[model samples]
Target: MATTLAQARSVLADAGAFGFPVDVSRRSDPVVGTRDSSRPEPFATLPRESAAIAGEVLAGELRSSTKSDGSGEYEAMQLLRRPVARATAAATLGAIDDDARNEVADAALDWVDALGPVIAAPAPPYRWSRARRQEDAARKSLEGRIEALGDPTPARTATMLAAGTQVPIAAGAWLLVALAERPELQERLAAGEVEPIWVVWEVLRLTPPTWATARVARRSLDLAGVRIPEGGVVVVSPLLLGRLPNLVPGGDGNPHQQLARLEVERWRDPHVRPGAWLPFGLGASACPGRSVGLAQLVALTKWATSASLHLAATPSTDQTRGIFPRPARIAVVRVEGGNT
Candidate 1:
């Protein structure tokens, strides 16, 4: 069934009437949490102090993936992982040092990897099972590193880092893929005529990292003309709703085409708001790290546009662990006129 912007917003707004779609019974699971308390705070607004730090860190990370001579091929998604991970760690755990940031970033990825089989498993594993053991080890390693920070509480830090690190990686990768395929946009960007921030929003609109979020019905009710029994699953797809003409600015062309392809200029209109499509999310469960995520993406976009991007192969989506470009390899033929 097609979901509209109004319906998606309505479903997400009532968090009380709807609950998380993930299994929340397992207290030991590193990924899923049952309570609102587990959701960290103050990250929704990225402080100016941290924004500069994050932007610099993100730019450096992007620069590092280039060849020693300053030009080379890179796995776009793979290249983005570390920088995004480290940037998110820096943004979420401000007290940590560079070395600790590296440590916790690596650990956050491990925890995310270990969570894959855990979620795909027929059921939650035994506490001592291999998946559980790997997940636990990664979680502990991350916790130990972040616990040294002493603020935001170690528990909040861990959750924030995990959620904050993973999604941005996927989003950044998608952004790069879009840029690589559209050379004219890349040229415009290199010429300093484009707003990198708008590129970030457009990318999110076409391919949001968290494409869909779920809610469980608390009690039987009819919603958006569908009847839901108690404990029923009510799904809201940002990807689907994003394609709706009403939410995205059509200008004079077919609005659905705007949904299918990246329109970097669609958001340039002053009257159009940046997030009508529900990329970060809505209501109490909406991601708090959104501001920080956007900052990191903007920084990445700035770095990417200045480089000559040549795709090794057309990148495809790997739905295995959320959406990231499958085999995300790309060649930076040159870094702004530098020879490889």
Candidate 2:
């Protein structure tokens, strides 16, 4: 419930103190919830290979979107879904052909949509409930596709798509939203006066899609002066911690003002680390596709800066779908005589 960064960091570091939210053992009875130990493969250790694959895929998609006619009103979030999904799908699926890779990409988005309601509902739905049923169907479809490609564990593949493809779509949407609003930053980005990586970091700091993550105590433990018995849950919010002035630099004014104001300059100082707020997270379960996701986003920033996209209307937040823009629609047109 608290937003203390150090305590959150401590819990994430100590695997003995806490385990993942769904790491419990499976119950035999149908009345009980299911357990999942299928963690996605981390891409941090495979930088060179991942960068080449995801970068090429992502760049090509962006180029395609800007083709035929660049002047069109588009829903920014909807526009990003396919490209991001394809990039992530390609990166994770290894040497799959283009057609098979596209099939998996569509399935990933469908599966993520099926999961939305289940995660947002107050309580868990029954196995036969609509949300659960839809989730199962989509999960099966995705898994079946992966199985068709000679992959044994489609379940892990589904998990990878859910975390890697879907979440990054939301994050990329937020990045576009930030760019649409911040004309000053956009100008700097357009002129190549500032680093595109900072735009990604600034957007993440402002509105991290996976705002909060949870961990449950394996046994009795105390955190930040609170004593909890066994099986207690602890929630760490990167969104809240990101607003902390102490963690990120460049907040000479009041706390609220500093946080509300986007500070791309925060990372300009070499002494201050970019990940003190843990946007992707820390320790072992800290998103295996983080580096891959960043590479995609960086390519996105490069494309966005080169294009001209204006927010059609003030984008509304859709908290039901894990903090995404409600109608992430925008007007995208080429900045004539500029880099198309």
Candidate 3:
């Protein structure tokens, strides 16, 4: 694995020399050909209008379900799922009618769900296995929906929607969990004493959804002084690189005292770059939805600051599909104007 930030960047930056571990030539999916050519990346800058719409959707959903059980508690994953899906879909399928956008969103979510088991399995299941068959059905359903929306690249669109939807859902949940555990930090955020973006950055650094990524060497090369033969695999871990002292401020001590600790102010230093750890990967293949995803998390943090939320139960890390907070239950104890 590339342990240092410099080494990680070196590997990721050499996109021509390194390629994804998967052998796409053997894949049956024709859409893979268009992935690199997909146009108008979803919410590349997350315009204000789209951001406002997403914020409204999130706020409306959370408000309606805030105290449904009189205990003010709700499952984080379930609570944010549809809203994230819809918001991402709207941003992805720009100018599309609401009905069509919603349909695509739901289909993308179904594809993501069906994809989870297949990804989490210990080994690739047989092509004719139930898991494979179900995943294939989900993919076709999503692709069909995207195609119906009139996207020139339906397969690429389907892939983008599914990828964008799932990661933000997990990232947003983690942001809320972090805020809930730190009332003082929330208060700081509420008072505008802290940057919401900083909080989001810290959470991403600590628990990035795509913690590690692999690259296969296209030819023999020297990486950070280590010789790697052609076809050799190298892993770059953002989670580990985020711990390096040079990359993150206040990470000069022990692991727990460093990036492991959620100190948002550590980013206050002007010279230290926020994303040097490359939480979203690097180079041409870096996450295309980063801006939209970051906007979603920042908006969530802003909303969270206006309300007091507490954890109803201890959430655990789920490694099934990237890292996520499983059973992330939180109680909406109070809103800005009144108790929930």
Candidate 4:
């Protein structure tokens, strides 16, 4: 009566080839958990298993290099790539079988190793709180000098970008959409009427801007006249689906309004159903590190917004992947009047 997990994956892959969007509607299939389902509950699980493997590779390589003191050319590259590698590893681990997980991990490590140095590191060394505070403080001081000079500084830009600040920019955009309908929420935030921490948690619980994701069918799947065959990956972009007109009550055409309605339906009250508004994903192949990712995003957003940091405007689009859709060039400016 239902399509097998393997069948669905095959369908997704095939559909991807033909440029068809995979339909991720609940009517089509159930979201399955990871292969190692016995480990723990989704939210409580530590990404340690995945993180350790990645860290080993990353740390090992850095240790072996002549610049192992954390100041060599490799340092900047590691700073930029490590998070991406960790996120990718976590996502891959969540999506694959146990056997494939190790392989993917190894492949990712090798890929990172091969990438050499980061031409443009994403964020500054100081932005990563994990780095020594002195380093961050010194970098912050230097940044002030560079800003005063009014000259473009690649290193500073790279460091800021790499420091995880960009995540909040994306989060803020999403929050703006959420606040559009509930102006009161925005007012409360501005007036300090609501606890900032609570707001962060609420935003985390809210589904991402995009909802469903699709992959192509590699082969024909013959169900009771459903017939989703090979080479037909019809993915539902959650952004579009979450805002789909029919899903909204009273038929408002605005995507933001639909998003607000969905949020209310899913999060505003208790006793909500489990599978509505799957922004991260649903089924066995959902993004595993979603909790950590959301945590990082919320933390980043709270810090940026509270400090009155303004981000440079940039274009962001979903390239059909359902996991992360963020803006490309999000520049930051401190309203407090210092280069951070």
**What is the C-alpha local distance difference test score of each model?**
0.75, 0.77, 0.78, 0.37
User: How many residue pairs clash per model?
Assistant: 0, 1, 0, 44
Candidate 1 regions off by >4 Å? 23-48, 251-253, 336-340
TM-score of each: 0.89, 0.91, 0.88, 0.40
lDDT of 4 by residue, 1-340 (tens): 1133333333333322222231111112322222232222223233545444433433333233322222222122223233333343433234444444334333434422222122122333333343334343444443443344353662332232222222332443444334433546544554565544444434433445333344544345553357765544445444443443343333355656544542432333334332233445444345544544454444333333322222233334442322222442222323243112
Per residue, candidate 2 scores C-alpha lDDT tens digits across 55-75 of 679878867865565667778
Cα RMSD of all models vs. native, in order, equals: 3.4, 3.3, 4.0, 16.4
Measured on C-alpha atoms, candidate 4 has an lDDT of 0.37
Question: Which residue pairs collide in model 2, if any?
Answer: 42-288
As a whole number from 0 to 100, the lDDT of residue 84 in candidate 2 is 90
Ranking of all candidate structures by their lDDT, best first: 3, 2, 1, 4
Model 2, runs deviating above 4 Å? 23-46, 338-340
Error of 3 at 316 (Å): 1.5
What is the Cα-based TM-score of model 1? 0.89
* Candidate 3: count of backbone clashes, pairs at least 3 residues apart or interchain: 0
In lDDT terms, how accurate is model 1?
Answer: 0.75
Instruction: Please write out the lDDT profile of model 1 over residues 1-340, one tens digit for every residue.
Output: 3288777777777765666655322443232323564332343454667767777788887677566765667787678778888888887777667897898889888887777777667778888899889888878877887776665476666777788887888888888788888888988887878889879888888787777777766667788788877667777877877787778876357665556877778887888888887887887667777778888888888887667777778777877556778877776766546332
